[model samples]
Target chain A: MAGAIRLAAGVVEGSRAALSRAITLVESSLPDDFARATELFVELTRQQARRPTAHALRVGITGPPGAGKSTFIEALGRQLLDGGKRLAVLAVDPSSATSGGSILGDKTRMHALACHPSAFVRPSPSSGALGGVALRTHDAALLCEAAGFDHVLFETVGVGQSEVEVANMVDMTVVLLPPGSGDGLQAIKRGLIEHADLIVVTKADGELRAPAAALAREYATAMSMLRRRWRGWRTPVLTCSSHSPADVRAVLGCVRDFHATALRSGRFEQNRSEQELRLLFSAVQGELAFRLRTDARINALIREQHRRIVGGEVAPRVAADCLSTLFVERMRGGQSAQ
Target chain B: MAGAIRLAAGVVEGSRAALSRAITLVESSLPDDFARATELFVELTRQQARRPTAHALRVGITGPPGAGKSTFIEALGRQLLDGGKRLAVLAVDPSSATSGGSILGDKTRMHALACHPSAFVRPSPSSGALGGVALRTHDAALLCEAAGFDHVLFETVGVGQSEVEVANMVDMTVVLLPPGSGDGLQAIKRGLIEHADLIVVTKADGELRAPAAALAREYATAMSMLRRRWRGWRTPVLTCSSHSPADVRAVLGCVRDFHATALRSGRFEQNRSEQELRLLFSAVQGELAFRLRTDARINALIREQHRRIVGGEVAPRVAADCLSTLFVERMRGGQSAQ
Candidate 1:
């Protein structure tokens, strides 16, 4: 507990190493580590309460593969750093769960930005379920804020539900699209377009400029038909070429403008509050699932029921009901036995 | 229990009304209804084991909105009915949870098929989480089989993870694309293409014919670059016009071929067994979540923690840990008190 408190204090004192260690502690699943991590969070929360300044602005950037998300983030991060903002880049790579290695937020991928003194880049958590990865990423973001990072950017692959997870944790969501990817209608149909606070068409330099503009126009038209996510704010579709400083600056400007508007409209605080509540519930769900999976009796019951289900002797739903009933009975039995 | 047994007997005897009622029972969340539903499934399982005949061929058809899914299903269903097959069409509409009504599986949308004596068409479940909806759909499909349906077709919107859910419940998955929608690259990027056992380019009539063929070729090329979902079975990309009987028949032929191949390779039974296990685990998770939500003490604790979390006195993760620990203690305490 003392070590955890010291670590928390170091994090609040803006030590990058301490922040990284704090994230590792929170991500640990061992019982002792989990307890210490909880203590660390409590201490961090105390320090946060004592000095409540404006929280760091969190932005989520997501795009389909080949959308140049890494290059774009590097460009954007450099610009943000030039403006004297301490930045942290975190990746939520759901694919890491399967591959056992993260494909996003590899420091080598964003060499200069990662090496910058004012920036922190952390790869996705390489193990556990997608939900676990998301929870760890959320903790890492909090650690970054405690370490005095004024801006946090979460980059996630846009192919699946991870983007939605990232969007829930961030103040703004920016979806990057490659030039000439096709009509925004498909993205809209996939429900990706609606989650975007800002849409950027990447690689809008040289011969790709025309197609990029066309894609942006398509998204703008599609977005106009949807209800605004934030009151009094319109989702902007812009073009960016990461190689160009001006394009990078324009995208950053849009992000800042969106953040300012969200803050002014009180939507920023409201979103944070709602997101925290969601986090609590999700954590509870995760814990329940963990308990269910780890209970020895439940596992034995599941194995026996699974055999019967596969053998065609019982319906899956029937087996499910049997297992759930057993679980509920066990819980009640636990209370009564005491 | 007696009523449930009688309903199960009716289902096995191919009574349509009894089958519908059984589905309703399984979909019900009321304690009494849930108990009866379990009894019904138990009886159904016994009868099923006694017969030990070849199970129904379950196929999943998913496509984005505006992809002519209903028209295609109706046309293909009519052809199957003409071939002396009993067909049941179920829609897994995740949207129904929010809209309080199902947009898919409306009898009017497939007027002739829904009115056919040998056909069964059911809309999506209108309440519950997506997991619950999926569980009910799984139960409904099993009920249809118990009632002697030779073919079960699940139609789901191809947006989000619902298609993945439907795919797990069926033997074959068919994805539909509209003509001139775009290159197959975006769909491939979204990871939708790999889930398909077959791809159909719909609206291949009149002026759309050329574009449909082009779209089919594009998907064919894209699919060629990836691995076969089933060994020795290359996913076919076909062009279909619901208005054309030949096109509809071609699509049906591909579905049957895929089903036949799957059965021959023993992949059909393997997939079903694996899906059953997944169903069992998901059901357990859902039950746990339900208990956590409905427990009055836990709810009160959550409310208190939520306030602190929103007030910035505690971090969300910290609150989550606190709630989860309390829940665990409550479970143990319940046992100890008894």
Candidate 2:
């Protein structure tokens, strides 16, 4: 408990090492670490309430593989630092849950930003359930905020549900697309466009410039037909090239405009509160599923039911009812004994 | 219990009305209906064991909206009927869960097939949790098999998880694509191609002929790049105009050939057994989630935790842990008291 309080204090004091340790603690699935992580969060939340720091803008950036997300982030992070703003980049990579290696927020991919005194870049947590990884990323973002980062960017691959998960945690969501419109088709299929607050066609320079512009126009037309996600704001489709400083600056300008509009409308805070509530339920579901998978008696029951189902002696639904009833009964017995 | 036995016997005797009632019984959520449904399934399984009926072919058809799925099914059904086969068509529409109106398996949509004496068409079950709807669909297919339907077709929209659910319940999965390659992009984005056992480009006639051909070629090339899903079978990409009898026959031939290969290799029965096991686990998960939502004490605890979470007074993970522990304790108490 004392260690957790000290770590929370260090985070509030803007200690990057402490913030890193706090994220590691939250990411750990060990029982001891989990309790400590909870204590750290309690302390940090108390500190936040007492001091009431400036509201940090949380942005989610997602795109298909090879969409130049890291390059764009490096450029944007440098621009933010130059403007005297502290930035933190945290990634949510579902792929890491299987491979135990993340393809996002690698220090090497954003060397300049990672080395910058005003910047912190954390890779996705290594191997765990995808839900656990996402929850840990959410905690890591909160730690970054506690460390006084002015802007936090959550980078996720748009291939799966992770992008949607990241979008829910952030105030604004930006989707990046490649030069060719055909390549952007997956983003549309994944319904990323619907969640996007801003869209960017990266590599909009040299030979790729025309195609990037064409893709942007196509998306713009598509967006015009769909209902607006945010009140009084149309999702902007823009082109950006990492090589062009002006292009990078223009993208940052659009983001700032969005943050300002959302804050002014009071939707930013309201969205955050709603997201917290949703997260609470999601966490509960995850816990229930975890216990169902891990508990010894439940495991035995599941295996027996599974055999009967496969043998055609029992219907799946009947077996499911049996298991759930027995599980609840066992839980009740434990409580009464206590 | 006597009524359930009579219904099960009627189903085995190939009575369509009894089959329909059995489906409704399985779909019902009422406690009395649930018990009746379990009895019906148990009796049906016992009858099935005694008879050891012929293995019926279960095929799943899925496509994005505007893919001419109904027309294709109608054409395919007519051909199968002419070949002296009985067919049952069942749909899994997630949209119907919200609208209470199914967009698939409408009698009007497949008028000729619906009017045929040898065919049965059932719409999506009205307004239930998606898992419940899916489970009911699975049971309906089983009942159709019991009623001596040689071919059972499960149709679903390609937009969401329903297609995947339908695919898991069937022996083969057929994904339909519209003429234009652009429209087919969404199918690829959803990873429908990976689950598909066969891919078809619909409306291959008149002005759309060339585009349909082009789309088929595009998909064929794309599938060539992907690793084969089923051993000894490369998913076929075909262009079909429902108005052409030869095209319809060609598709049916392909489906038959795939079924033959799967049966010869002993994969067909193995796959069915695997699917049954998976269904058992899915049912358990669904039941657990349902209780979490409907249980009064659990709901109250969730509301309290949600409040604390939104107020930042408790971390989501911590709240989840507390709720799960208390829920288990409560369950134990109830069992002990009983």
What DockQ does each prediction reach against the true complex?
A: 0.33, 0.30
lDDT of 2 by residue, A27-84 (tens): 8868678778878988887887888667589999998877888989999999999999
Candidate 1: list runs displaced more than 4 Å.
A25-36, A46-54, A66-68, A98-105, A127-131, A178-191, A202-222, A239-250, A297-338, B1-6, B12-16, B23-39, B42-279, B291-297, B332-338
iRMS for all predictions? 3.8, 3.8
lDDT of 1 by residue, A1-338 (tens): 78977998899988888988887777676767766777888888887788764579999998887799899999999999999999999877766666677666455577888799999988665565323665677778888988889999988888766677778888899999888655553553256666899999999999999999998898899889988886888899999999999999999999989988998989998998888777777888887677666766556668789999888888877888777655554443433332
Clash-forming residue pairs, model 1: A334-B334, A334-B335, A335-B334, A335-B335, A335-B338, A336-B338, A337-B338, A338-B335, A338-B336
Model 1 per-residue lDDT at A48:
74
lDDT by residue (B1-338, candidate 2, tens digit) is 89989999999999889988988888776767877887888888888899856758999998887788888999999999999999998777766665577766454567787888989988766666434665777788888988999999877887766677777888999999888656446645357777889999999999999999998998899899888877888999999999999999999999999999999988898888778767766776766676666776556668888788776777676677777776544533333232
Error of 2 at A172 (Å): 0.6
Model 1 over residues B150-242: C-alpha lDDT tens digits? Answer: 999888887756678777888888998888665553653256567899899999999999999998998899889888887878889999999
Worst 10 residues of 1 chain B by lDDT: B329-338
Regions more than 4 Å wrong, model 2: A1-10, A25-55, A65-67, A95-107, A160-162, A177-190, A201-225, A237-250, A300-314, A322-338, B1-9, B24-129, B132-138, B141-278, B291-297, B331-338
